[model samples]
Target chain A: MEDNQIKNNSNESQKASANYDVVIIGGGPAGSTAAIYAARSGLKTLVVDKGLTSGALGITSKIVNYPGIVEEISGAQLVEKMREQAKLFGAEYISDKVIGVDLQSETKSIFGNGGVYNSRFVIISTGSMGRGVRIQGEDRLLGHGVSYCATCDAAFYRNKDVVVAGNTDEAIEEALFLTKYANQVYFLSQTERLAAPQELVETLKNHPKVILYAGTKLKEIIGENRVEAVLAVQSDQHEVLLSVSGAFVYLQGGRPVTDFIQGQLEVSQSGCLIVDSSFQTSIPGVYAIGDVLCTHVKQVVVSAAEGAIAAMAIEKEINGRSRMMVDWSEKKQ
Target chain B: MNSVIHVNDDQFEEVVLKAELPVLVDFWAPWCGPCRMVAPLLDKIASEYSGKIIVAKVNTDENSQWAVNYRVQGIPTMLFISKGQVVKTQVGALSESGLKNLVNDFLAGKN
Candidate 1:
């Protein structure tokens, strides 16, 4: 009976999902710009973003160099403005983290944490804040003990020791979650003090199951098959090894965000997505822009310009046009 | 015609370990992001490879007993069991082709 209910519910949800003409990932300058151009061109567009501050522009304190905006503005506020503009142009924005994608099929399917979206075109503008380097044995023990998601794997480590590395709020929240299942939770922050909110930090510090290790660098993950221990350096001299069954690493690095693609698309040597002059990737109907490009200039105007190019290219492809459409002419006035 | 069975702690032995064919058991929950990503793929495999293999899902949120017994320290942990013995394990989301390759390898005894 329950199985039938589940199947029916899944089918209903799948039916509820509306097919879109374009699905843009990341709502930063590039993604929002793409949404604006695509939606204004009468194409049904949807933008899926993790959050306001998920991209580099989101974390930027002040963006004064952006053209047409004389006032000093925060990256988050600027992004919000772009998002609003895109929405005004008929783009639907949803706050959801894209977990995976299947771009080979005619209708590309983007899987998010909340729901799935199907579209004719996909834009890759997730930026360069993705993790690039892996500690020793981290890759080998990925399924065994090394995991990026704590919520997914924390339950499996019941009564076992685990380590949560990183200083972000996400890492702290995961560490706190692990306390419920794991016998002990070791919180390792590379910084002297975590940049996350103070209340969350205090809670993690005061938690009975947590052992806080600040200003530590994770040197390596020591294990044969699964995670047996973690080798870390404290204060640049002291080496600490903690026995653990799991290692939840939320570390961030400066590389193109392509993990979600799962090696289906082409990337450059530095892990940046390779795109043509039109911002179209190696795969047809797929586009990439902004900081995800290796030669990308990390500027708001640059990203926005790239987004415009990609969106126009997408519009051209969708309409089967040999020449690109120039919309600068006064709109039939 | 059998889809992926939502096997519980009690039915695990009979429905999976003692199944007629090898079973690809997925330890998952609704809240897990990667688990959500693997769900649709598992459904397709369950239907397409019905007689060749059994795709069993153990929702760890409710049925943690078997998951604990298997020492599955990850969600979406696919344990390939042949003849009631664990043969292979994959612990995260894979691309569509990646999943297909893993399934083919599991069926080919190369896992």
Candidate 2:
């Protein structure tokens, strides 16, 4: 009798989730923007979000250069507003981690722990979380000290020394977050220059607790049970060992989050989905956009634009399919 | 219990350990942000699994005995108790769906 009640509760939601015309897979800026456009175009749209602060933008502390916005806003706030706008325009949003996808057939299917969704057109707006620094002891001591998300694990290292490897936007933003709890933070960059935004770069350059390192390669993470120090090589051919309790590695050359769709899509050498000009992948009804594609710039505005373009293209395809001409004159004869 | 019951130090054993069904005890505090966020989710799960599981919360401030006994060092720590013994413990706040998955798995004896 108790099992029947649980089944009934789930079945109610499953029945409400009808077939969608366009299903945008990620609930980031790219996917939300796509949902806003697609839903406004009179198409049934659904956006699936991987809960647990899982979006690339959610990790971003602040974003100032998106154009039209006067003041700086946090990434999570901006994404929330975008989702709200999409919802206002009649886009359904659900929080579920997608486990697998089957886009070969006419009706593309997405499988998740929550439920399975079928759509005629599918958009893959799932962003990339750049490559990981695979130095010695990095993988073995993952939860011990090394962490990928500063928001999730920064609280564990209160008033302790930590190292943030790499100089990308994510790296610098996470380094800033670490400065809150960490007594001292070392921002290590392998290249000759830092790739973070000028505003953040300037802030880190003058911060009292932040120490910046340029033209340095992280060689190893030293520790017994937890992170103890980091071994690095400078441009002057000098080796330096910095003592730190925690290390946050943000490596260069990031790939898309396409492991679930590994056997389904035709990805490039760098793991980016190979899509045509219309953001349509090798499969006709399947589309991909944002950092997951082989695009040059990875700005939020660029991803939003790609989403708009993909939505318009999908609308056109849906309309064309309805008006598709078939010759049944021979059968009648 | 179908609804969320406040279990204090005096009533912890009777309300949770002695319950016929499996119990999930939430060790939380008022000031903790993640603990406040997970309260509603636990309530929803309690109602969904009414007869199958008993969900209860114990405020660490008012009830420190159980928290200290379980060695719960963090806020929003959830203890999955079965047969009067804790089978699993999870720390931190999870999404609604994440909690649902965990509860469903535990109910199915997959834990």
Candidate 3:
């Protein structure tokens, strides 16, 4: 009996050491939103992120489209605002990549560069990653004129000639935004027609500072240390030199980072989490929200809403667990 | 939060067996504390690896027949199934990396 008691005590200590109320992975919009809600519910919440400055929406230069923000705001500024809001609610922020998570034990643990974190609930908000521009000098020239986010670095090229590469709505909108700061903005589309919205297309067409080039593929970005020019292939197979101080590659779709959670969770071929209406996955205490889930449209507002809903469900689960403990205690007495 | 698809006996075969990717079925109950601990990890993984895998849950309390057939002796038993066969069985909670290695191996056609 004494041996059994010792074993039980060790197990209890292990459980206590591994226990946390909630640990949210990814400090982007979805994760931060979840943190705000979770912390507001009086749960001990920790948000782990990779410290990437630009999220999906952070790539946009001016977001006049997002609801509630009457005036247009830069993507970086908006994300910072969101981060501040989450912090205001007492959400602890941990800047690190979560290498792995342990869910099989009674106390869930998140393994990362910093250390292991144990939590009963976790929200994964690691947004999609920008697809790499596979070519020589691309990596080396990164931040030297070759950039992915137009919103974050567009201001740096004020009064200078710049090139925008992409055919998506966000890309077109970014090009339009660049016209304000850039002397001349070239909107290069690889497709025959611009894949952006009709309204955005009309806006770009009428904008005098913007130059639209269709079926133009970026061949190579040339510069000694900074981007000075780009070799572009025109639709007629004509090669043209585009002189620009900076080049913004605005690829639309992004790939999710799900390699870390592969076998334990059910994911779509596209790496989006499959969830029902309650945002619950195949596992009970687990829930997914935002761009990571299987959704037709990926937007900031949608992700925020999903975060709220997931937090509410987690709250219910926590309350249910507490009630069960109370009932057990009463029965024992 | 999106609603979870309740994979009962009627939809089990189609959702779990016919899935193109490997299916991870978590057998759990509401009152189980360990089951609660593992739920978020499963959800994080399901969303993180969506499309590459299919995640389903069988509530032992609600789906007693399925639980009986699987001979589940405890809550939070995870069965990793591929090609309609149980490839791996984990009885307790697992770390994210531990789960990732298992799934990656299965996806890579490695035992």
Name the best candidate (by TM-score). Answer: 1
**Predicted candidate 1 versus true structure: per-residue lDDT over B3-106, tens digit per residue:** 89889999999988888798999998776667877988999998888799999999987898987787677778899999899998888888777888989999
DockQ of 1: 0.39
TM-score of chain A of each: 0.76, 0.59, 0.55
Two-chain complex of model 3, DockQ on C-alpha atoms against the true structure? 0.02
Q: Clashing pairs in model 1?
A: none
RMSDs, each prediction?
A: 4.9, 12.0, 20.0
The superposed Cα distance between candidate 1 and the true structure at residue A284, in angstroms, equals: 3.2
- Enumerate the candidates' DockQ scores in order: 0.39, 0.03, 0.02
i-RMS for every candidate? 4.4, 11.9, 20.8
| CAPRI class of candidate 2 | incorrect
Instruction: List model 3 lDDT by residue over B1-111, tens digit each.
Output: 232345987788888878787888888654344455567768877887777777788876567677556655445668888978888776545565676777778778776
Each candidate structure's TM-score, on Cα atoms with residue i matched to residue i, is 0.79, 0.50, 0.45
Model 3 lDDT tens row, A46-114: 887655353565555677766889877876567668788878878777654455565555566676533
Error of 3 at A140 (Å): 19
Number of backbone-clashing residue pairs for each candidate, in the order shown: 0, 2, 30
